[model samples]
Target: MIYIFLAVAFSVAVSVLLKVARSRGIDIVQAVATNYVVAALLAVLLLGATPEAAIEAKATWTPLVLLGVLLPAIFLVLARSVRSVGIVRTDVAQRLSLFVSLFAAFAFLGDTLTQAKALGIALALAAVLCVLWRPERGATERGGWAAPLAVLAGFGAIDICFKLVAQAGAPFASALLASFLIAMVLCWIAVLVRAATRAAPVTARSLGFGVLLGAANFANILFYVRGHQALPNSPALVFASMNVGVVVVGTLVGAFGFKERLAPVNWLGIALAIGAIGVMASS
Candidate 1:
């Protein structure tokens, strides 16, 4: 339970850091690059992962490379989503990515889809529609859905990649380290490309915020992974609780702390998201 709460807290803290980055006019690309580097270092120090071990794990590299490419791309998309749509919607969409993971479970992993899981997916789809539908502007708004949709799909793909990594039987810490290292290289390439194009000069402030962001991001993953390990037989509970906690807390913070306005349907979506998690967990 403490691990669950810590995961939730750190997850929310990530969104908060990105939100603050937007407020402070930080160069998010640079910050994200720095974040990967910091997270990789922390994984080495805290998780006791050796680069040599990761390098020798042949089965891990495919997912590790995919994750490396996807992590920064998704982080950029997440930052955009947080900035454009506020934390509540972004967080909801992010958690709803569980649908994709479940779909992958059924499609590629040979997991049987029970009725409850099917219904949960249906309800979650409805929740996404409701949450993203803008009031008084019809269903489609000007560029409103893009970031949220990207966040949804991006996170889902990431979840699938993690499942693949786990299936390979690599150590969690080493796998994470490998992914982070790859992500760092990819992000730095982007940073270098942008610097060459005069996008923005890298600054120390970005590095500072990135350290904070990296610590929180790694902590979130570490705690969530540890929590699941601690409750190996009750994965459903951990999944349901973690997602529910993030959605609920994100909505509250977005609404009250950030003064983001939500239509009634968005509130309904939040409720449905909670229900969907419960239903899926039961399955």
Candidate 2:
């Protein structure tokens, strides 16, 4: 129960951090890379002298190793999509990844697909559709298939990597640590390449925002990892709940705190997300 609350809280924090980081003129890719570096460092400090132990425990670095390539690749693409597609659309596309992940987990990994899980997955789908439903006059000046399409692909890939890691015969903590490390290295390389291509000025404002992002994002990942470990059988429904929580919080913060307006359908989507999460968890 506590794990559930913590996971929701972590998702909310991530929402807040993303907005704050953007406001400070921090590049999303840079911010994400910094967060991964921070998360990797924390994992190293906490798990010290245990690489061999962790690797031995997992025996198959397959999932974590794949995450190394999968995370940075999609994340960079998602960052671009966020700017072009807008947050609402991007969130919807990412959460719609529930369908992709649930299918993969069921077909390949044999994760539980009970009625309760299906109900949860359905609610999650409703939320995604609602979030993506643009009002009649809501179209932006730009309309391109590239960004949204790429974001969807990126999210689906991420979900696949997560499901694979979950199915690996290893301690969840070890798998998590290895995955973070791999992601950290890949992101670092990306950051260097960006630095060489163009000078991204990291002002005090950017630095401060990155640090705050690192804190919240790392905390989010840590809590999520813990909740994943505590939850049995690595149900895709649980991950669906995580995405639904993000939508709920993002909508609330956007409406009240940020004064962003929502159409009627968007509001319905928010309610559906909450209700779905409620049904999925308490059933």
Candidate 3:
């Protein structure tokens, strides 16, 4: 439970940091790139000393590569969604992505879906729709569909890929190292390209924020993995707690801290999402 709490706290912190980035005039792409570098360094420094298991963990490369490519892309989409749709809706949609991973578990991983889980999925789908619903307004004023859709699919795919790596017997540390390493390389290329072509300034602020972001990001992964390890027999409990915690925490922060407005329907959706997560986890 402590691990789950830490994971949720770190996860919410990441979202809050991103939200703060917008007002502080931060270059999020560069910050994100630096974040990857920091995360990679931390992973290597922390886990690099491990012997046999770390050396043999290269077998997980396939999924690691996919994860590396997806991580930055998804982060960008999440930022865009937060900017366009506000954190309340974006966080709900993001957490609701568990529906995709759950479906994949049943379809591809040979997991049986009980009625409770099925009902949870149904309620979750409804929640997603309600949260994303926008009242009729000027076309220019409304956020479009693309960023939210990308957020949904991107997170779902990432979850499925993680499951694949775990199923392939990859040591979590090794897999984490591989992912951060590859993502760092990719981000370096991006940062360098922008520096050459766009002359994007690299500021001390970006590095500072990136380091904070990196710490929170790495902690989120580390703690979530630790939570699963601590309760190996209760994957559903860990998953539910983590996701529901994020949604609940994010909503409060979004509403109170940021003063983001949510429609009554959106509020209802959030409530339904919590219920659905509970049902799915208990199933």
The TM-score measured for candidate 2 stands at: 0.74
Best by TM-score: 1
Find the 10 residues in a row with the least total lDDT in model 3. Answer: 47-56
- Residues 201-272, candidate 3: write the lDDT tens digits: 677888788889899998998799889999999998998899899999989988998898777877888999
Residues 1-283, model 2: lDDT tens digits: 4665677676555555564555557776667667776766776676442445446645356666877777666655655655554555555566565556665676777777888768867877777566556565453423433665566666676767666655555555566667777777777676678777786643456556555666666676666656677877765556656767676665666567756557888777667766665665564
Candidate 1 clash pair list? none
What's the TM-score of each model vs. the native?
0.94, 0.74, 0.89
lDDT by residue (tens digit), candidate 1, 191-215: 8898888888778898788888898
Q: Model 1 misses residue 42 by how many Å? A: 1.6
Q: lDDT per prediction?
A: 0.89, 0.63, 0.83
The list of candidate 1 runs beyond 4 A from truth reads 51-57
Query: Local error of candidate 3 at 181, Å?
Result: 0.7
Best by lDDT: 1
